[model samples]
Target: MITATPRPSATPAHLRDASLVDPLRVRRAGPGDAAALVALSEPFVRAGALRRRPFDVYAARAADFLVAEEPGGLLHGCLALRVHPDAEPGAAAAGVLYNFCVARQRQGSGLGARLLGAALTGARAQSLAALFTATTGSGRLFLRHGFAPVPQGLAPRAWARTLDPRRGARVLARAL
Candidate 1:
């Protein structure tokens, strides 16, 4: 069986500094984590790194989130995975990752990689054929994890339709 947590060696060298991270810090988020999730993603939202979602939205979709918590009761990072069954009548299942953010102090410390690794595991658990994401930045992290540019027309239909032209985000996908 695939474990939900990432093994130390599963992360790429460039993405995580193993000596600075705790593999166990990343855990599934519960409804109780809603507010923290919102707070954690707030900076990204303000910087246009992510879209804004209110508190109730976070509470309602808490099940879709995975969060990295510090021993001091702070959320250091978070990522959400929304599974979409198919793009066409017979396409394989797939998932879209969103609201990905790591505390500014925590960036480049492997917490983000560990979070991504965990979400990849979750996607596999759901029998997903691919994982997709839209990013406004260089997407270097996604590239290191094997994601490549995907034409919007080739991405999951339902999910692709939601992409905002105003954001000018690039679409990327990694097939499982």
Candidate 2:
């Protein structure tokens, strides 16, 4: 059975405070961030906002992650650049953005934009010709970031299943 994602019982007090003051801070997540990352992502997983991988999987891959934390350290949103094994020698490396989320109340603060920009920057640095992701709600944001959809039936690994008949997450790519 799929696990249910947890919603905030109430906005954390610090977020209320941040709403009155600074809204966010972005930084690399470290070893200590595993639990918080899980908390931040659990809701999405439960809601199918992301594919549910075991906690250990996330922890094992944590180094590629980043978070937008409120001043009180509540996890607001996260994004990661997970490298895929090269399919061809000397080919441009490729990576994907996973678990992209913004806290329920913080959805419009440009956090997704910030997160995607960082992912794209990392992709360029790695000489990746393109960056890819599967979106849950809309692909417009990815399009704005220069990602175009992969043609129907030609979707890449993991991405093919991200989309369903109605709410299918289309595969998008941005040339690096």
After superposition, which runs of candidate 1 have C-alpha atoms over 4 Å from their true positions? 1-24, 87-90
Clash counts for the predictions, in order: 0, 3
Candidate 1: give the clashing pairs: none
TM-score of each: 0.85, 0.76
Tens-place lDDT per residue, model 2, 1-176, is 89999885986677665335556787888878888888888888889767776778778878889788878988888898877655578776667777787888778777788777777777778777667777766777788888888764433455445556565666777767
The count of backbone overlaps in candidate 2 is 3
What does candidate 1's lDDT look like per residue over 8-84, in tens digits?
66767664556355643878889999989988989999999898999999999899999888788789999999988
User: Ten residues in a row with the worst lDDT in model 1?
Assistant: 15-24
